[model samples]
Target: MNRRPLPQIVLGVVIVVVGVVGLLRAMGLVDLSLDDLFSTWWPLAIILVGLAALVAAPRAWIGPTLIVTVGLLFQLDNLDLLDVAVGELLWPLVIIFVGLSLLTNLGTRGTDDRTINSAVIWWGSARRTTSQQFEGGSLSAIMGGIEVDLRQAGLADGAEISVFTFWGGVEIKVPPTWRVQVSGLPVLGGWENKTVPPADPEAPVLTVHVTAIMGGVEIKAGD
Candidate 1:
């Protein structure tokens, strides 16, 4: 069973609620200030975005977990519930996260594994997978970028890659013989597929499920 992404479901509900609220306000049935409400609860949106990333790509958890943590801190501070200043502590945390990611090879590295799990945070990564049996993988870019070349890889049956990009970008290069299917929810972001499928009806298919928040994802055929 294919379930809808949590982020997409939450977004739809939020949009409906907002529309209903706006209608009620216009009808004079309710008195409310959306600007003030948003100002107070804006951090929740960040938290949800992080959650969306986390859910979309669970293998790449560090970056999304950091995002959620930061969002929580901001939310607490916004409500005057935190003693320390978030701005003062965020830079050091960012440094630590970057260091950890680099050390773990999750931030940047080349892999020939059939299944790849990669996450890049606050930095850039370039990976070329040469796996003969290319399987699905999870890739994430948080305040960073990742370029993955799968042109030399071969897909067994059909493969699916899950991606999450928050304030970052992801570029994927595949062979022209593969059939590309790109589908996902983009929150203030977008994704594009530029791969040309071969004429064979049974051509290998590559399905990409992406959640982009204020970022972009591009899949194209390699030269």
Candidate 2:
């Protein structure tokens, strides 16, 4: 039998043991609180499972570790170790780390395959408008050769927009009546803006801000 199958067997046994333990506790054979199950014991189980998965199938560790970490973070919030708001803020970091790890693994595996590497581009855009407010959002490719294009996405009269990219190129075309702020360091390419002016007092203007790392960015005036 392959060494990979051993991890699955071990995982199954561990889960069965947990189920049996829970049943025994519910029947008064063992005394355990929900707090104990969630805080101290659960994290240990997570670490153990993470190790097991890493040994059995390295590629599968990302999902299990992510689930375990998020579950533990929520448990910490419940136990008052972390503020709810702080926990919420940190949740994205956890996801980002997992995504980065997954990407790193994929990159390593695809190093010899240029086609796979070049297919990593992604693009997205959104717009919102109302009587008192206008909003627009977009995210494009990240570091590497990714490309994102957002054209005329934002509130009509007055708009607030934010764009984010990691290690990639992004281009946005906005109405000529919008104000723009570009911030952050691009590892490779510099930022460029065309026809962007200071805040306009008389004209209803849209505000656009972009954040990126190690990438090229271009923003242009449009209809």
Candidate 3:
């Protein structure tokens, strides 16, 4: 019969302990705050587990363990630790980690396919005679696309609108009567505006400034 090495046995024991503890915590039998665990003991745990894994399965787990250890170290707020561990080494470490993860998962794909291709669509319109105002927020639209229609909305002065897209497009349609000023490079495509009516001095002003990379963008008047 083959005997497992000491390091492998230790890793197995540690993993079993961690799994039991996590299960207990999830079932409310243990009263441990995830935040405290992650901010305090988790880093040390990660380091120890990583070291043990490196010794037991150097070919399989060394890279992942190192990546977790480094990430945990970076999340710590200690300036001294950051200065020593990061300093000029931050970008290089990030590049190496990303490259290795990509290489390791080269053949594995579609684990998060649904989230990768998700989008958001919104529609709102009002008559110009109404005193109602239109308001919108982009916090929910992060990392995805958002389509907003305000052409017929009876926009009031001081109406608030914010668009935040991390890596996708944002399309806003408004009456051409409103004055517009954009101050950001949105992908390679240019902004599109259609002719409508003269600007209403009392009408709310529409301001849109979006920042993105490699994401196509288009904005025009919505009828």
Candidate 4:
């Protein structure tokens, strides 16, 4: 399973936002203080985290939706738009929600594969099938990730894959001796080919055509 850790990026972004707010307060740009913002807007943190998980976990949305709804309720209460002790009841409800989400995830059939003909991931992870002979295909990812493990796969001569990514990333791990070519335009993004050089000049070729906008595509040599 390609479990791309999501919390670090989200947490780093949250930290930067908090730091910026602190800087503005120090510069006397706004009258509010950090503690004040935290007390009133902390629920938003919960909502953002839930959104990240919902997008990256590839699970049903029921759990994330409930968590988002609860965060909204608490936000409204903190804003004095509602009269409720949601903060006091939040932790217990969160515990229960975690249990429910776990139960829901237990129903999905997770498998390992390496060959992909076509796949779309909006906010999750996609893995290619493990077939040794791989045919080119199409992949699309928006705010998600796609991982292809080609260590056991062989390329049909001139095999090609078209990949489109927006605000997301794609990682391909291939055998050390495969010949790979990556060509594409990266708008506010990048393409990295870190595969080891092939042992022979007559090795197979697999071309990856990528369109990355505010995202990245990385080709790495597999262990």
RMSD of each: 3.0, 19.1, 20.7, 10.7
The residue-by-residue lDDT of candidate 1 on 1-223, one tens digit each, is: 6877676898779779988998998999999988888888888878887787767656556667778889999999989999999998899888877776665564324556677666778779777888878887877788899888999999976688888888999999999889998777688998989888789998899888888888999999977
Q: Rank the models by lDDT, top first.
A: 1, 4, 2, 3
Compared with the true structure, the alpha-carbon lDDT of candidate 3 equals: 0.45
Q: For model 3, how does the per-residue alpha-carbon lDDT over 132-219 read when each residue is reduced to its tens digit?
A: 4544332112234555555555555544333333244556666666655443323233334443445576545655443333344455
lDDT of candidate 4 over 1-223, digit per residue (tens): 4432454366567879889889988999978778977988999976865465355322224434555778788888888897658777777765665565345334323233323533333445545455556765555555677776677677776677766665778888877778887765454676798986687999888887665657788988876
lDDT of 2 at 216: 61
lDDT of 3 at 32: 77
Off by over 4 Å in 3: 1-131, 139-143, 185-204
Off by over 4 Å in 1: 1-6, 103-111
Q: Can you give the lDDT of residue 33 in candidate 4?
A: 76
Q: Which has the better TM-score: candidate 3, or candidate 4?
A: 4
Worst 10 residues of 1 by lDDT: 102-111
**In model 4, what is the error at residue 55, expressed in angstroms?**
28
lDDT values for all models: 0.82, 0.47, 0.45, 0.64
How many clashing residue pairs, candidate 4? Answer: 8
In candidate 4, position 55 carries an lDDT of: 51
TM-score of each: 0.83, 0.35, 0.36, 0.48
